[model samples]
Target chain A: MRFFINRDRFVHDVQNVTKAVSSRTTIPILTGIKIVADHSGITLTGSDSDISIETFIPKEEEGSEIVRIEEKGSIVLQARFFAEIVKKLPGQDIEIIVQDQFATTIRSGSSVFNLNGLDPEEYPRLPQVKEDLLFRLPQDMLKNLIRQTVFAVSTQETRPVLTGVNLETEEDELNCTATDSHRLAMRKATIERNNESLSFNNVVIPGKSLNELSKILDDSSERVDIVVTENQVLFKMKNILFFSRLLEGKYPVTKGMIPTQSKTAFKLKAKPFLHTLERALLLSREGKNNVINLKTLEGGQIEITSISPEVGKVTEHIDSIDFEGEDMRISFNGKNVIDALKVVDSEEIHITFTGAMSPFVIRPTDHDHYLHLFSPVRTY
Target chain B: MRFFINRDRFVHDVQNVTKAVSSRTTIPILTGIKIVADHSGITLTGSDSDISIETFIPKEEEGSEIVRIEEKGSIVLQARFFAEIVKKLPGQDIEIIVQDQFATTIRSGSSVFNLNGLDPEEYPRLPQVKEDLLFRLPQDMLKNLIRQTVFAVSTQETRPVLTGVNLETEEDELNCTATDSHRLAMRKATIERNNESLSFNNVVIPGKSLNELSKILDDSSERVDIVVTENQVLFKMKNILFFSRLLEGKYPVTKGMIPTQSKTAFKLKAKPFLHTLERALLLSREGKNNVINLKTLEGGQIEITSISPEVGKVTEHIDSIDFEGEDMRISFNGKNVIDALKVVDSEEIHITFTGAMSPFVIRPTDHDHYLHLFSPVRTY
Candidate 1:
């Protein structure tokens, strides 16, 4: 393979693909990135069994030449070394030439690096999914959807299915939910369905895959086409295709866990409340669960406090708007609440409590599209 | 004790002192910062036995009030927690009050923290060094001297003395040197001696202490009075006093190791050569010592290459200025050369090599105040 490409564009594409490459993969060849140069452009692929990312750079972009192809061929190079070299290579243009025994020489300016390349034929092929688009959404909206629910996914592997976000469709709205049993985050987005009658409810995408995809997704409002098959899902962006294997288990039903009634409810400014909880957490963080206590005060006031037996205590008070129903006290893991509040985009957050020991709900006061549920800790 | 202090200035003072406090210290009280409030000012001190940092905030500075002291007393609080709380506390002024049994209350805005404090009497006292100033140098120059030599200090504990930088005084020049046996970095600065005949040849300061001190030093050219005692060194800055325990041992003689005669010599732009070596190191870093080869080519040119038998090779070429010796080939650790080049203030750096098997010297082409020496690797 012999081709010369723009250094900046090549570096960008290589970084995107490298997100899927694992340096400690059991399959040694999977540690390399597969590169193919053809008449149209060059393609780079990286996979680690669970996730595969492929990015393509065309020969010409916007009437400007990006890649000049001298020969059509393929080779796999160690992803870590290749990525580092590509980032640090000098000059505006980089030339790569493959010789006998799959040895490749990369040249730019006054620097040349010869790397031992693996035979592309030995690399595993990416799963082929039907290009039937399941749904479409703006890149920024998809990123928001991922950010709102991904952090709630269980990091523990005890329940492997909970380690992924569950995506289900009902009519024109798609509901994404993630929970580790202690807390649940749910987001609803209106998506354009390719087929009105087509729907899938059991798709569970690994939280890690979504996190990586979020990092690579652009902030632009460009449309992203998503396709899901029996065991895999594909997110197709401009010239990048991200494939992730579905978690092989049924996701637990979480709809019944969200409280529908409240014994007490109050509205508070989200940012101020977040800050108060953060300060309280400074003392509670020494404890394993970071537990903090919240109590309703007279005249629409609330007090938050945390204590580490040996360290000391922190107490903060914040004003609540439209507090109603009953005065109550509750304890919870402050970190989980902090996470939910960080992703909340509303100026005012509405919180409701069924009882001191029951699950609570926090949702943006201005919208009904999203809500977070937390199981309160029983404190003596 | 009770006081109301400006938040920003208090936070800065607390952060400076906390640098000397370690949470894992065997002496429990050493993990806390001792705070003493007098009629004139409030002083904060932290010590890990080897190093101590104390900062003072006067009741009034210029014409503005920085601290309003209600009573004079002292207490010790956990440094990590106190620093963190002081940083995040809201409000322009923070109010601190001490109650019975050393319990303390800190209030800012609507936030209040009750912390358990230790008796200030239990905190170790700083060494009482003679107040006679040993010498004076600009703070910025001292920072530069530390940066130039500290990186070369031996990290291995087998030779405890090598873990510190040796500072020797001769006339008005203070020579600082550090070596890890493989490479040596030396820097010299002219200082105003407080005593004409006072000199110390065996003064060694721990590299770790220098690193911490460097972080606290400002970039201003303001003169800093340095006092050296039998077992301690004190650096008196504007409102901060940094004390470090001198390493107890004789430093190895390194002056004679710098080769004065050379078989080959050349001058190269420091930045460009640094970049070239960085690129070369990218390939050689996988090897134990990151060894890279340099060979003089015809027409005042040099080629740098590195190979990892299993991986491939990288070759870069650069033109040398005033190349004045026979063609020669040598191999050295690229990382060491890169470190030395990073600290060179001059545009051009002169390098001299006696033979492939002997040590070489690298110094700024403009001045003789600083030089770096490295032992070449033996390669077949």
Candidate 2:
């Protein structure tokens, strides 16, 4: 492959693809990034066992010429070294020429580096998904949906299905839910059908993959095409494609776990709630399960306290403007609710408690579509 | 003891002292920070076996009240947790009250944290160094002197004295040097006698301690008083005292290692040289001793090249307007010179070579007192 490409643009594409390159890959070739130069532009592909990422740099975008193709060829370079060298190259443009036996020579300014590359034919082919089940959604909403619910995904592999965020689509509305048995978070977003009927269910994306995708995804008005097949899901951005293997097995039904009735309810400012929970956690984490107790007051005031037998105690009072139902006290993991409350961007959050031992939910005051539910610790 | 101090200032002092606190300390009480509040202000201290750092917050400085003491007492609290609590406290002013049996209650705004504190008497005593041997220097210059030579200290514990930076003073001039046997970095400065008699020659401060002190130290015009004792060195500032134990045993004789007669000498811009050496190291590091070959051309156009048998090769040319002596090629550890180049703050550096296999000296064009010396690799 012989091509001269803008260093900055090529570097951006290289970084995006390298997210899928892991050192723990069982296949040796997967440790490298597959690069191919064609008439249109250059494509870089990287893959681990579960996820594959491919980014393309067009010959020219807008009025600027990003890449000029001198010849068309393919090669796979060690991803780590290639990324570092590309980033540190000394010129505005980088030229790559793959010679016989995959000895790739990269030149920038007065500096030149020759790296040992492998045959691109050794790289595994990217899985193909049917285009029929593709749905379009705004990139911002998709990112928000992932950020809101993915944190509660079970990190333990004991229940492998819970380690992924379950995606179920009915008509045009898509629901994403993740639960670790003790705590659950759910978010819902609408997808544009665009007349090409797209509806599916039982697609579980590993929470780790979702987190990495959201980290690189730009929060812009650009739309992202999500293609879901029987075994793999693909997220296609402008020049980048992120492919993740669909988790096998059925996701547990979390609909029955969310509490519908409330023994006590309060509408509290989300920021203060987050801070109070964080401070209480500082002490409770020093104790055991990060458990903090909250007692309702006569006039909408709630006192939060965390006591550690070894390392002292912490107490904080949060003032709630609105309160309803019976006054009660409950203990729950401070970190669980703290994580949930931080993702809620509402001015106020409505917290509903079923009882001292049952599940309670903290939801945006204005919206009922998104909420965080957690079971309380039996402190009594 | 009860005191209400400005949270920001208190946290700042705590951070500086905590650098001396390490989790690897054997003494249980050494893991905690000793805090004493008096009528003057509060003093915070943290210590490991090698280094101790104590910073004092005065009641008032330059018409600004930093601490208001309500009662007088002393106690030691776990450094890690106390630092975290003080940083995340919710008020502008933090009130710390030590009750009977060292029960420390820290109240900020409406939030309160009760921590178990041990009696300050249990904390290990700080070393008392005599004030007779004290020299003053600009804090900025001291920091610069440390930065210039500390990186060359041998990280391997094989040579105990080489792991520390040797500080030697003769009359008024102070010289600092560190070498890993392969390369040496030396810096010299004139110390102000200020009517106090101070002269020392056999003190070697641990490189780790010097690095930590330099990191927290401010590069200002203010003077830092350096007090040297038989086995310890104490640096005293207005409200801060940094104490470090000196490494025992005789330092290696590195004076004869610097070559006086030169076969080639050239003056080159430090920046381009640094970048060239950095790039060469990237390729050479894949090989043995991070060796990079530098060929001094007739017109002083230096050609830098690094070749690895397994991974490819790299060649970079550095342009030098000034050239002297015959053409010769020498290979040395690129990382050693790269580090030396980074610490040099000069626009132009003069490099003197004494033949192909001998050690070379690189010094700033304007200064003759400080230089970096490295022995070349004898490649067959």
Candidate 3:
């Protein structure tokens, strides 16, 4: 392969593809990035058998020449060294030439590097999916959906299915849910589908794959197409395609875990409550259980306290914006509550509790589209 | 101790003292910060037995009340939690009260924390050094002097004396040197002495202690008083006094290692040469030895190359502004050269070599304040 391309754009595309490359992969060839240069453009692919990311740079962009191709061929270079070298290359344009025995020469300015390249044929092929079952959503909305639910996924391998986020689509609404059996986070957004009758409820994607995809997608409102198949899902943006394997086994039904009734309810500013919980967690975190107690008092006031026997105790008081129902006390993992409050977009937050020992619900007061549920700890 | 002090200033002083506190210390009391509030002001001290840092906040500074002392007492609180709490406290001023049984209450805004405190009497006492042998130098100059020599200290414990920087004073100049048997760095600066006859030839301060002291001193031209004694060295700043235990033993003689003559010499821009070596090191770093070769060519040109048998090769070419003597080839550790180049303040760097097997020297072209010497590796 022989081509000269713009250095900045090439670096950007390489970084996106390398997100799927893992240094711990057992397959030796998986540690290399596959690059192909054709008449139209150049394509870079990286995969670890579980997640694959491929990005393409065309010969011309916006009436400006981005790449000048001298020959059409393919080569795979070691990802770690190649990425670092290209990022620090000293010229505006980079030229690559492949010689006999797959010895590639990279030249930019006064520096020249010769790297041993592996055969591109040894790289794994990405899964193919038909575009028949496709849906579109704004890039910003998809990023938010991933961020709101991915942190709640179980990190343990004993329940492998719970390590992925469950995506369910009915009509035009898409609901995403993740749970580690201790806390559950659910977010819903309206998506545009090619077929109104298309629906799926068992698509569980690894939370790690969603996190990588979120990093690559910008916060623009441009639409991105997603296609779902029996065992794989593909997210296609401008000139990039991301593929992830679907987890095996059925996801547990979590609708019943959310509380529908409340013995006590209160509304408070999200930011102040988040700060209070953060301070309380500093002490409770030293206790190893991250437990903090909350008690509602007269005159719409709430007291939050945490105690670590060996360290010290922290007490915080915040006045509620509104209060109703019976006064009650409950204890919970402050870290979980802090996570949910950070993603809440509204100014005010509403919390509902059935009792001191049961699960409770926390939601943005201005919207019913997203909510978080937590299982209270028995600290009495 | 009961006092309400400016939260920002309190946080700053706590952070400075906590640098001397380590969690892995064998003594439990050493993990806590000792605070003594007298009629004048409050003093915070932290010690790990080897190094102690104490900072004072008076009742008034520059016509402003910084501390209000309601009572006189002393107590010690856990360094880790106290530092974190004071940094995130939500009020303009923080009130600390030591109750009966050493139970302390810290209040700011609506947040209150009751921490378990230890008796201040158990904290280690700082060494008392007479100020007869005192010298003063600009804080910026001392900071630079430490940075230029500390990185060359030996990290291995086989030779405990080599792990410290040797400081010697004669006349009005202070000379500092550090070496790890392979490379040596020396820096010198002029100081204002209280007694012109006061001099020391064997003051070895631990590299780790100098590194910590460097972080606390800002880059200002204000004067800082330094006093050296038999077993301790004290640095007294405006309201901060830092004491470090000196390392015992005789330092190695390193003056004869730097060559006084040369067979080949060259001068080049410091930044560009640094960039070239950095790029060459990228390939050599993979070989684990960090060895790169430099060969002089005709027309005042130089070639730099590094080869890793299993990976690849990198070749860089540059034109020196000045070249003299015979053409020669030498191989040295690229990382060591890069470190010296980064700290060279002069725009042009001058290098001299006696031969391929002997040690070479690198110095700033503008002055003789600092110089670095490196031993060559036999590659042929």
Score residue B352 of candidate 1 by CA lDDT.
95
On residues B1-380, what C-alpha lDDT tens digit does candidate 2 reach at each position? 89999999999999888899998988988889999989888999999978999998989988999999999989999888888888888899999999998899999987888889887898988998888657888999999999999999999998899999999887789999999998999999989875545667879999999999998778897999998898999999888999999999999877888888888888889988888777778778877579999897656688999987776788888787567777889999899999999999999999989898999999999877689999998878
Tens digit per residue, CA lDDT, model 1, B1-380: 99999999999999999999988899999999999999999999999999999999999999999999998999999999999999988789999999899999999998999999999999988999897657999999999999999999999999999999999998999999999999999999999987897788888999999999999988999999999988899999988999999998789999889888999999999998998888889889988779999999999899999997777999999999999989999999899999899989999999999999999999999999899999999987
Pairs that collide, model 2: none
| Candidate 3 accuracy as lDDT | 0.93
For A196-259, candidate 3 gives per-residue lDDT tens digits of 8789998999999999999999999999999999899999999999999999999999887888
Q: Tell me the spans in candidate 3 whose CA falls farther than 4 Å from its real position.
A: none
On a 0 to 1 TM-score scale, where does candidate 2 land against the true structure? 0.97
Q: DockQ numbers for every candidate?
A: 0.82, 0.69, 0.79
Query: Candidate 3 at residue A48, lDDT?
Result: 86
lDDT of 1 by residue, A75-138 (tens): 9999999999999887899999999999999999989999999999999999999976579999
- Between candidates 1 and 2, which one is better according to DockQ? 1
- In model 1 chain A, the worst 10-residue window by lDDT is A128-137
* Winner of 1 and 2 under TM-score: 1
Clashes of each: 0, 0, 0
Arrange candidates, best TM-score first.
1, 3, 2
Each prediction's RMSD to truth: 1.0, 1.8, 1.2
TM-score of chain B of 1: 0.99
lDDT of 2: 0.89
